[model samples]
Target: MSQLTGPVPDTVFPRLGWVDDLVVPALREAVGALPAAEARVAGYHRGWTEADGAPVESTPRRGKAVRPALTLLSALAVGGSARDALPGAVAVELVHDFTLLHDDVIDGDALRRHRPAAWSVFGTSAAVLAGDALLVAAMRAVSDVPCRSAAAVAELVGALMELVEGQSADVAFEEAPAVSVPQYLGMAGGKTGSLMGCACALGGVLAGADGERVGGLREFGRRLGVAFQCADDVLGIWGRSRRSGKPVGSDLAARKKSLPVVAALAGEGAAARELRALYASPHPLAEQEVVVARELVERAGGREAAEEEARRQLAEALRALSYARPSADVYRQLQEIAWAMVRRDA
Candidate 1:
């Protein structure tokens, strides 16, 4: 087993290679049961196949598969075998992909994972249908888990609802005159945190963990997810294109009300005033305006504030890990994972 005591993995399989052997094949098994068209879209979105469903030359899978890995790790943290949590892992990964598919459609983002998004290649309707199919498949996978797995199914459903609500709020925020930091955090918690919490909780439920510890794992994942989002918000405007797979200021170009933007607009300074005026226009930011917006965000201290929030949430996540009462090694492993979530360079 590869050690799980570092930052997030860059490759499809982390140095923690255990997930490669277990999670990938099981995810394939779950997705393999879908109809041909949905499967093709799913496969392509997952980087498992070309847009036509033909196999791609072997390369690192586009995503880090972090949610699935967290599910399996939660199983281990709860003193259960990773194999026993395969269904949960598969369900989490499917749900994540489902969200990404719809998110691209909603955001009108043409790229994903450094390539054309599924909706960009396939029709938007087809991508939406594929996302719907994945949702069904995810629920089916959860239900297949042995004994008392009903809880897992319910939790996944709850997360999906929460995710939808967050996404809805996000859409609304774009047109709203002002959005508070608290509102942004709440949206981030739901949009990103809910499923992450569900990933850990489902693992615990499937592994037969008790309610208290399972709940603890849920909170831990929830906090970590917020941290992850904070990092992502920072990256959205400032991250390197080669590492992030998206051009710098992509979020700015879209006029997204991301955390940093909201935080910056909260400022009382000249830069913040200028930024608010720039963002008030209904149209997307022009290319040069994106550059100006980046500068305004930094000048208004949004970047530092967002980065600090990420650190704060990371600490909170570690503190919450106490409730899970994992073994020393497991505790340390989770600590590493929490750090990675907030500290990712991409």
Candidate 2:
């Protein structure tokens, strides 16, 4: 459980660079090759143009496409042709975008990838419809996988259900009087971890890996997902406003029951008391109070605890990769990517 205490390192997967080049083209083609029904649905869902003369590109600007890369790479790692996994790649990317579109609307977020969010540019109704369209498109894309693998499609659907359930819990927790560490973990596992697991599982499935190997990759993805969320929690608190493209302590101000706050509430003595007071108070937290609240959570060992949990999850992910018995090179590359994920500055 080594701590990634400094700057993130370069990717271990050299092939990942090559995959990056292929991904955008593959995604574009996958979308383009869809049946007219699916294509129209996706275009409408993305809000590419309005009925009026005005045009707005609701398509989210290009993202890193990390999830799809993982799916394609996992397929290659397990001895399958990356080309065979293209539909899975397209399906997962569409699902991710769908979630983002809905999430932006739910969170009332204005910015995404440095541009106005879909909900901000189009109305919330349009954004919601777009998200729905993307989701349907994902299913359509997966259905086109040449082998007609029912298991892979079922796994993807299960992951989507888990995602929705997890999101439900997240919204519920915000309204709860208090949230425990376990509850927070459960929400994160559902909302974030499941999709990553699906990516890896889909890869293994496409490669025709044995059950044990597929299970191992699934666990690896799940652990990495948890670590990813913990890292996000860390950023939500201590990240610089300019660097994160949001105001610092924004989570605290929203009174969201994130992990750090949960840990402080569950810890020993005065720091815990002060946090409770802050949570209980109706008055807006002043700038200095926000700083003090962060320090209090750290002093209460909440920050350390969260970091430890992240490390634990990362170690578990590495161990799962061992079970997959990947090539030493591939394993090391995955480990490097995992480390970079936790250590990323943005």
Candidate 3:
């Protein structure tokens, strides 16, 4: 429940400052190439109104393109040029944005990346359509990659299936009586980890990397994704109250079945009873209950356990990288990115 401030800790890899200059432009270009497609779909939602209205400025504004960057970097690590992997990178990013568009609608989230969510502004129906548009666009973009192998297409499809399954599990957990730690991990793996795994795997496959080496990259991404979700869970509860742009213990308020809460419940101690009572209560959690929830998570060792779990996943990610056969420098940079995922503040 402690607040995190200042720079994230450096653990396994040195930060590479060059990714901004090297990778981002490629991503932009890949996305830019689809303007006609995005515009066509935008028409479906608003029709002539959209065309007559001031253009939705193509501002270089979006959430951190971390997933796409991972795809590009993974390809580079395997000796492929970023340009060569642009299609795969764009495909993954489109899929991610599509998920977010739908997720915000389902979760009733009003804001995303500091802006009104697509659903909030466009209405749920339009938002759903936009999400579908993005998915179709993603497939089209990837399909345009000349000479793409069948195996690569299959991997992308598999990732999409896993993503849907994970999202379904997440929604189901909200109403379920109890969620075990393993179940939560599996959900995170399916929702977030699968896409990341595909990102790395696509990179390797495009570069024609050996199967064993590609498998290693996929493992690296999977572990990193687990660690990333663990860190996010910690932040959802304990990060700066204002900067998080949500109430403290917002997860508790929403009755989210996160790792720490599930762990505290499983312990069958005072914390568990208190949580069950609070959750069962008709009244909203007052400030005092928030404090109590924090205490329960702490006293039950949930925070420490979650952190340890993140570290374990991070170690697994590093181990996978060690076997990936990347050039020493590329391997170092990729490892750095993985460490950054665990250590990021937001």
Q: What do the candidate models score in CA lDDT, each in turn?
A: 0.84, 0.74, 0.71
Predictions: Cα RMSD each? 3.5, 4.0, 4.6
| Model 2 score (lDDT) | 0.74
Please state the error at residue 39 of candidate 3 in Å.
Answer: 4.7
Best model per TM-score:
1
| Each candidate structure's count of clashing pairs | 0, 0, 0
* Candidate 3 structure quality by residue, lDDT tens digits, 198-270: 8888888777788888898888888888888877777777765322244447776676777777777777777
For model 2, name the residue pairs that clash. Answer: none
Candidate 2 lDDT over 52-124, as tens digits, reads 4235555433435667777776777787777787778778888987898798899886765445666776678
Q: Which candidate ranks first by lDDT, i.e. highest?
A: 1
- What's the CA error at residue 46 for candidate 3, in Å? 19
Off by over 4 Å in 3: 1-6, 9-63, 241-248, 282-288
Q: How many backbone clashes does candidate 2 have?
A: 0
Itemize residue pairs with steric clashes in candidate 1: none
Ten residues in sequence with the least summed lDDT for candidate 3: 43-52
Which ranking of candidates, highest lDDT first? 1, 2, 3
Off by over 4 Å in 2: 1-5, 9-15, 30-63, 241-247, 282-286
